[model samples]
Target: MKAIWGQKMAKVPISWMVLLFMCFWAYMADAEYVKYKDSKQPLNVRIKDLMSQMTLEEKIGQMVQIDRQFASAKVMKKYFIGSIFSGGGSAPAQRASAETWINMVNDFQKGSLSTRLGIPMIYGIDAVHGHNTVYKATIFPHYVGLGATRDPTLVKRIGAATALEVRATGISYVFAPCIAVCRDPRWGRCYESYSEDPKIVQAMTEIISGLQEKKSQLVLNTMWAMVEQPKVSMRTTR
Candidate 1:
């Protein structure tokens, strides 16, 4: 009877050990080292924490952008690609709907988020005139025409509208509002310029603010200014 009691007492310790192990495991699982994930932290502190954790490969990956045609979850996961862009005429399928666009972006995002650090990839589009890549999206006049109005407020409204449409397609970046002050008409991209007048070009930068200030303030809006120097070669185009 003493031997049996001894065996039971030994089993009690084993159960206690298992319980203690489970508690330890839970605490470990809940532990978070990602101070960057906390928005309340100062921006500089978050940037420092994230930069400290990144490997050289990860830093390089963050700087590299690839076209959407070459992008997939597997490719993104493997290369840790930072940004994905839809170059001219690139779409998931011909005349893809908003839902299709969202799914495609989300798929790429999943690959990005699955990485060790879970840095999400930024998706960009050459949405200069509007969300022109999307089917049925509004196509606004180029900057040259908008500049003719000499009304920055009107330009701002158009930009806000363009931002709304761009967001509808699940895009996070715009390569737009071609802020170039075209000095020469011969430049191939002269139409992209708001005006030859530097003042008008400066006034039209209101578009940038419009793109960033969404109605709900929900989007992580980013814009790429495609500034142009006078292209001497572009003189041959028109």
Candidate 2:
């Protein structure tokens, strides 16, 4: 009778342990189903919920755009960088492959998403003419040449092709379609100008529509003179 009683006492604790574990698991499952993670919610509602949960440092991090040379997984996580960019001639190597570019961008993305908020970082590059930074990408004619052709359809096709090449390397934004009216041939970047005439510039804006399919924003370079000095502002506001 003593031996049977001891065995029953041991079984009581085991049953209690199992029940406690199940209760704990139920709580965790409920916690994981947060409103911010629900896709059915409206975008604004989702954004509001996310913003409400983020710390001030995290909100400030989203405003900064870091260059690839200075970017790292640790830095991205620590600062919560919102975007990464590759300037002209800033490829991983002299002729980095498309796969290499994609992998590099993905690594940065992983770092960004590893933070507490898990927000994805936007990747950008100077893919003005094809994926100019990557090897084996199609090298299209310059905007000046394309403008001279006077074919909006061909220009639009080029823009679409450029967007594809940029995406192949995992970049989501492009610095392209430089809409500058070059009044002087001596300017260093005069070749980037589509034409001296405003009409040509207006017509070539169709490229904006082609590039918009990928949710990519066009980097417009507009030079306006001030009374005292020439201020060169690289505006991506549009």
lDDT of 1 by residue, 66-121 (tens): 99999999999988899998977899999999999999999999999999999999
Clash pairs, candidate 2, are none
Question: Considering every candidate listed, which one attains the maximal lDDT?
Answer: 1
User: Please, what is the whole-model Cα lDDT of each candidate in the order they appear?
Assistant: 0.78, 0.76
Candidate 2: tens digits of C-alpha lDDT, residues 91-160: 8877888888988898898999899978989887887767787888899888788889888888878888
Evaluate model 2: give its lDDT.
0.76
Q: Report the Cα lDDT for residue 159, model 1.
A: 76
Once model 2 is optimally superposed onto the true structure by TM-score, how far is the C-alpha of residue 159 displaced, in angstroms?
Answer: 1.2
